[model samples]
Target: MAGPYWFARNIRAGYVGRDRYGKGVMPIAWQGRAVIAGFVAAMIGGGATMFLLFFYAHQMALGVVIYVILVIGGAGTFIWAVATRSDPDKSLAVYLAERQRARSTGR
Candidate 1:
């Protein structure tokens, strides 16, 4: 079965090939993992928030507190996604150039 395409291809080629300085970190994979992790965390957080709202339904102040917490959590998730930006095409270009140079030098 064909899988989702990343960076216009799904080949198992390691761009940057794990440099010592870790500068070659592939942002595509990291971004995907971060999104998945964030979604899961959000789901759990929403559930917990709902539970708290239900538990404290008798108190109007508690409900308001829960609403604020949920709103803040949701905003935090959005901000986190924005903060963890990724540009895989540039990384792929670097990888290709390095490979070409290595092959040309017979390394």
Candidate 2:
């Protein structure tokens, strides 16, 4: 899935893995869980949505309901993962900031 594909797309631009790289490495379980939840939820929910919309074009409301369910369910999973994560989201923000600073400073 593109979610997993992009989630694993290493921001480490040096043609190699860096321990400090955020996008490629899953140093934390919570983060991995979040990614998994999003991908799996999207796959299942999106497939269901498409199936309904394709087969039951007459039932537009049903498709909308399915999409809403997917959104809520997927959000629930993500919230749970994030709530359990010991590392705060700020860590990632800080990391990206440092990376950007490094690149700008030509380190």
Per-model tally of clashing residue pairs:
0, 0
What TM-scores do the predictions have? 0.35, 0.42
Q: Which is the leading candidate under TM-score?
A: 2
Compared with the true structure, model 1 gives a TM-score of 0.35
| Minimal lDDT window, size 10, model 2 | 1-10
Q: For candidate 1, lDDT tens digit of each residue in 1-107?
A: 00231222222444444332233233244455565466567667766766776776655566667666766676576455534443333444555666588789998
lDDT of 2 by residue, 14-63 (tens): 44334535543332334565666685877687668867796878666777
Worst 10 residues of 1 by lDDT: 1-10
**Cα lDDT listed for each candidate:** 0.51, 0.54
lDDT of 1: 0.51
Backbone clashes counted, model 2 = 0
Best by lDDT: 2
